[model samples]
Target: MWQGLLAFVALAAMAGCGEQNGPEAQMAQGQAPNVKIAQPLAQDVTEWDEYTGRIEAVSSVDVRARVSGYLEKVNFKAGEKVKKGDLLFLIDPKPFKAQLNYAEAELERARAKHELAKNDLERAKRLFRAKAISEEEHDARSKGLREAVAAVQSAEANVYTARLNLDYTKVRAPIDGRIGRELITEGNLVNGGGADATRLTFIVSTDPVYVYVDADERSVLKYRRLGQHIGAGQTPVRLAVADEDDFPHQGTLDYISPREDTATGTVTLRGVFPNTDDLLSPGFFARMRVRGSTPYPAILLPDRAIATDQAQRFVWVVNQDNQVEYRPVTLGAHIGQSRVIKEGVKPEEWVVIEGLQKLRPGIKVNPERLSLAAPY
Candidate 1:
């Protein structure tokens, strides 16, 4: 029984040895040298950042009626671009005029009473000196005169307030901007106390418009470290309308927010685009591009050349013998369709942009001469 067991173990060992020494196994080991590889390449890439920006007017205001009254007429067209002091809407001034007249009449009455009180006080002063009237009567008359003066002042203030209400009947454009649709039509009562009575509409400044965008703090910090001030005159912004194939107009940076947005944790940047022809409007989404200082002699690669290995980024670089080697690279911000290489590469090196799926380190490459084609 022992001899049969030993014979079975010997037969298994011999079969394993034969399989290891087979011709098929030897051929598979030598095939690693034939695999293709890529070399590092150079490219002129401009780094760009894409942020979802909202088009906003530099100045936006809501027009509201001050006095509670019926909207008599709308003077301007809805959605019309209006200038400052342009007539927007007119509320019925009949009520305001009546109140003004009442106030003015009261003021006149108070003035007449004040004149009478003054004359009476003067008479009391003269009579007191002659001892014809008691000092108490003189004091009372003097007090009455003072009270009459105060009443006159109060009436004057009321008249001024009434005039202000009358002026409120005419809703005028406070700023030069494009007016929105009127919220309340003629004969509709606008909220006197608040903007409820009539929504005169919104007016937003379209000329030298604002583009509000956000950038990650890290990217902003990186930009700051480069010692570039993204300010007006220094920073030129180019904008592309949603449907336009190309960016037609350029703008300047207007204002940068004092603090970063806490909710999104990004800095809010606003750029003012000149709208000479009034082509750009508020609430229209447009693609904004900002130029940064191009650090000349930057190393770059096509977008697909680099890949993440586990958690680290690495690229395949080919040597003179066409042998593939793995290289870890430090990546900077994306520039256009390519990437900016901060480290681990040099100029004039070929990089693998395509055919990277079937590639590994230490494999030989049969490099097919590729035509240097300009990117579309």
Candidate 2:
């Protein structure tokens, strides 16, 4: 009987202890998971739109002969910098010089004939005054003098033409630019100043180059609206050529097509950039970007904070109740370490940046708010 009473007492004590520990076990287990939260950064930022484009010279020229002749000499080295009025090529100047000399000689002979005719008219005038010559004879001498004067004028014009032909023998650069290879080498016969004129070479302006891009209708409209506040060239732009990691070149939007292409439904845009270093060249593949909008206040969060469920992007927000709630957000371009949240997220809201996996809608969390600055 004593053993049975001891066993019953021990069982009663164990049962009572177990009942007390049950509530404490449940209370202490699975405390709210600790998480880090931060308010979205409010900043004023300007967004940019990117496009792929090709570099083009501000001006390009196809050098051609202006007078038919055998090319006597090439004045410039292939791939050289040339300035306006710089002599580029010399045609067979010997022929042009001879023509000019012949014209000058003809002009001198015309002057001598004009002088003799004037002398004859004077003599005829004296004879007419003394009645030693008929009126018809005096008129004939006067007419001869006029004909000689006309011949002199014609010869003068021919001399001017000859001088121009002589100058054409020396082909000069029409613009300041970089010249390419000599297409018609020395001693080659070249046709000039007509439909069949031979091309001598090519040249293109180097500094302050242009970049052209085709922008869609939507972008065109946006740019037009932006233009209401800012001028066309006032919009900031940047460019990067092939092998460049970043847009080191700065420029501005200079031109926009008056109409869109009916077939492509896109408009052309041109940006002009200063290339003092001559690093940018014509026909180079490049990447360009234009400022999308004026600086505006925006909310930003770390990219890692945002989670995607199917196509929907969301973030876990801790409300005043210290409870996690699912919130969808509209994200914009990445700005350094943070992403712009255009909509569905407020700058003052606490967004869970870490320990996001433990979050569930309506779940309580121990939020340790942090002050995290964007790297950008």
Candidate 3:
């Protein structure tokens, strides 16, 4: 009876092991992994080529005195907004005023001399006509009158120049802009009107700023082929400063270099933007993008959906049988979180956006349908 019992127990243990390794148990433990899948977003999209660029003022000027003088007063506060023609600095006007006074006095003396010569010439002309004076004497008086007229004109020019010098003593802003700190303070002697002129300050126009960028030769050729010419203002551009995530500023292509730089093989391009709020400033680093292609129908997938195998980018697509298929894709520019699909994926096919690590080609998946329009 003990021998029979031992054999029966061994058989029961073998039966239990078989049940544990049965197909039902395997099916229960190894169900297909759930994945989120959605059809590619289809829209008319324009590809934007991105570039790093620098912000520049539309107009920039260095403030300097037009006349040599002792600086009397710095009219503007350091780093203030000033309008065109606003007084920026004042030079000592006493010396210029004295020179102007002397010029006026000389003009008056020249006028008196001219009158005396004119009267003498008139008397000589009458005597010569009445045969009361020699012709030589009358000619000398006429010559004196001509010399006097020239002297008077010279004096008048001197007076005008003196006035101009006096006006130059008051330095004014040449353009509307935010001014830099005063470089030369009051009581300092400032030289003017040469290469060595003292720089008083600087001003850069704030509104309608410029952004300059360099584009590769291929990009420039593409733009030309699209019928866009230099300074056409037809090509639209968007800009974002270093602190911004999105391009909030809108501008137009204003300039393109006539020749490409031989060393870099790139062409310089400029865009003009209106800065009403004064947020954009010169010398700031910014990211700018231009519309590279015309609007066309494109299939878009979230950047997360894209996977890389060596150099090839691909995504997993779910077919009508709910089996994951490997699809290689060609990508274009990125639009927000989505990438443009130049080829490979179709608009109607669903692509796996989640559970990518658990997927294999031809594997069945529990697909949860998602709307591409909704946030991923």
Model 1 stretches with alpha carbons more than 4 Å out: 1-46, 223-241, 244-267, 286-294, 304-331, 342-346, 349-376
Positional deviation of residue 116's Cα in model 1 after best superposition, in angstroms: 1.6
Runs in model 3 with CA error above 4 Å? 1-29, 227-231, 374-376
lDDT of 3 by residue, 354-374 (tens): 989878788788899998872
lDDT digits (tens) for residues 1-376 of candidate 2: 9999999999999997786665334334647778999999998877778899999998999999989999999999988899999999999989989999999999999999999999999999999999999999999999999999999999999999999999999999999989999998898999999889999999999999999999999988887778777975688888988898777899999888999999999899999999888899999999998888888888899988999999999999999989889999999877657888989888788999999987778878889999978545
The local lDDT score (0 to 100) that residue 173 gets in candidate 1 is 92
Score every model by TM-score.
0.71, 0.80, 0.89
Candidate 2's TM-score? 0.80
Clashing pairs in 2: none
Clashes per model (N, Cα, C within 3 A): 15, 0, 0
Per-residue lDDT of model 1, residues 1-376, tens digit only: 9999999999999998887665445434654323323344455555555555768787899887788878899888878889999888888999889999999999999999999999999999999999999999999999999999999999999999999999988888999988888888888878775535445688998888888888778866654543354443456667887887556678765555668889989887666788878888888887887655553556666677788889888777777776667888899866655577788766555555666765677666655544333222
**In model 2, which runs have C-alpha deviations exceeding 4 angstroms?**
1-38, 123-139, 302-304, 308-311, 318-323, 331-339, 353-359, 362-376
